[model samples]
Target: MAYKARLQEFSDTLDAEVIDLKKLRKLVFNGCPDSGYRSKCWKLLLSYLPRERKHWKTELEKQRNTYMQFIDEMIIKPGREATEHGGLADVTLDDHPLNPNPDSEWRAYFKDNEMLLQIDKDCRRLCPDFNFFQCASKHPCSRLCGKNSFETLRKRVEQTVLQSESVSRNRLGITNMSAVKRKSSSEFVPLPDGQEAHWEVCERILFVFAKLNTGLGYIQGMNEILGPIYYTFATDPDTECEEFAEADSFFCFTTLMSEIRDNFIKTLDDSQCGIGGLMDQLMSQLKEQDPTLWHKLQEQDLKPQFYAFRWLTLMLSQEFPLPDVIRIWDSLFSQEKCSTFLIKVACAMLLLLKDDLLRGDFPSNMKLVQNFPYSTFDVQKVLKKAVEISR
Candidate 1:
């Protein structure tokens, strides 16, 4: 009975002509019923789509088309052919890869490769316990169908693998050079035509994001953050919404990063808005809520940085499994101030584990917080406790 009542509430909130965002947020604070509801709610919560129902189609089309333009301009390398619309005419002699000029596109492309490599590494290993990211998407990037010249990131990775003969490494402060025979070119298999793996889509979105935001380009744990958002949208039941999940995910992620970019910027680490400041806020909440636990942590020198750094920065994505992370995000995104409320959630986690935390010393408590006991964890209880702490 309660479930049906909650379902009706969400249906009413979402079905309204112009959504009452406050009502929607309150309903979503508990978590969406399924991916279908979650998909629409996340887009609305992230401010990717406006509240007006009539404008949804136009807004989606406009933003999606703009995203494709970004892919065309940024992802695809320009050819040597002269086109009617500024091709060779725009090229300068100093624009080659070896050119010392800072403005060279080739130079920027190479730098982007370095960032792409890191993004690929992190994304490939994303949520190892779950096979969702590894599975091929039912609805791939159909928008990229005709652009055969454009290289998918998977192909780029295979090409890189085939080209590299060996890599140098340092072991125990000693330079070790060894011949590493990587897989042959023939060993690599390609995905079926018109189909790309889910991780590839994630990699492409992050790459585009890094290109657009040059200031704080491609931080490592961003893959963890993007994983849940992409999963929610990509798994959406609406075929139309699922089809353009990539573009939608990109815009939503961009909006989200704008709010948390300060956390990723090192220069602003100690600033009030950065991750350091966020952890400090978490510690303060801990002290106020459970002084004994907080003081014991202080006595054992269990700094928040040792554990809460990843929690606060990644919004607790690392501490929990994918499903729990999504549920937690439901609560976090629904709030007016997600980051500020995250401090309360962190406090809630400590208060729930107060007995263990207060009894243990530094090493045990550190390990406990670093690798959360997800096996017995309850997402709803933690969130309910988080609300209590907030009050």
Candidate 2:
């Protein structure tokens, strides 16, 4: 069937609030270009979609409000000194820095200060190559907040603090890492709260996700995984869809992690189903299908963990271009067995460059594979080759 016809058929089912997964799977695997369709399709594939479509509005309201609540609680003013504590009227003598009580709200807030700093750093650096992640606001010209947003908060905190202590010193006295710093004297400067709306939104989702799943909590590279998902949703042509991207991305990401959580768990790395198992599986397939190349990679001591660990765990999101990464995900989620297909794509990636891989020594081969420019890569060609090997 033609593309529009296929979409029409899908739309009919969608209107009925019942998706035919088998059909949707075929569309996704082949490649979905319609951003609106992809936005919805992704939710379904990741199990973020309700079984009863009638409840979608309710489900969305529940999830989005939950995320907003997280933003309100987990994300707060770095109100410390009276100058900074402008917005936090709730901060009282009980919440002051000197409070040694473990249960003090300030104590708990200060406890994660270091981790928050790290997450802030990583989130800012996410997809730095892409301006979407590098800047705080995509369009700083129309932004409502920036350098002095905190100053406004300070006044609010000061008024609230006035009702209590004359002033409260910053707990941990830590600098706000989220502040936008000027990188150069160039006129084209990004604001401090720079596309902060987006980056900060991603941070809150990760924090909420950590609080929800204490076992895996927040991992270092999670921002990388979350980046593409949010970008895809936030950029959807439909304004309504883009507006709720954060809530949708969170639920989708949570479902995606459920399928692959073992990869992030330290205890499971050595297990057959963990990252080690995945690496072994990839090599095993290479050994069976392309023994010569498999042996060549192993001979150079270019272990799969060195490069493929990130590849598999991140669903190749970091390795491929953003657009290609989405296409790759289209294929990944469409399959009945996602892990099995992922190994095939990885194998196909290796096999496609068999000649370069065949001739190079250890360092040369490692650099070639690890830092290859996937931006210009032809993912369809790789998928074609991947499917051939899978059969």
Model 2, 1-391: lDDT tens digits are 6777877866765666667888788878887767378887788888877756888888888877776555444545443322344334534454566677786656755655545555554565567577665445342212322223232221222232111112322111112233344343332232453344466667656866876777677767777789889988888887767777777888888888888888877678778988889989998988988889988987888988777887888788777778888888889998876897999999888888788889988888888777655654588888999989978
Highest lDDT among the candidates is held by which one?
A: 1
Worst 10 residues of 2 by lDDT: 157-166
**Top TM-score: which candidate number?**
1
Candidate 2 TM-score, C-alpha based: 0.80
Model 1 lDDT per residue over 203-301, tens place: 889999998988888887888789999998888889888888889999999999999888877777778878878888898888899899889989999
What ranges in model 2 sit over 4 Å off? 76-92, 134-197, 373-377
lDDT of each: 0.79, 0.70
Cα error of candidate 2 at position 3, Å: 3.4
Total backbone collisions for each predicted model:
0, 14
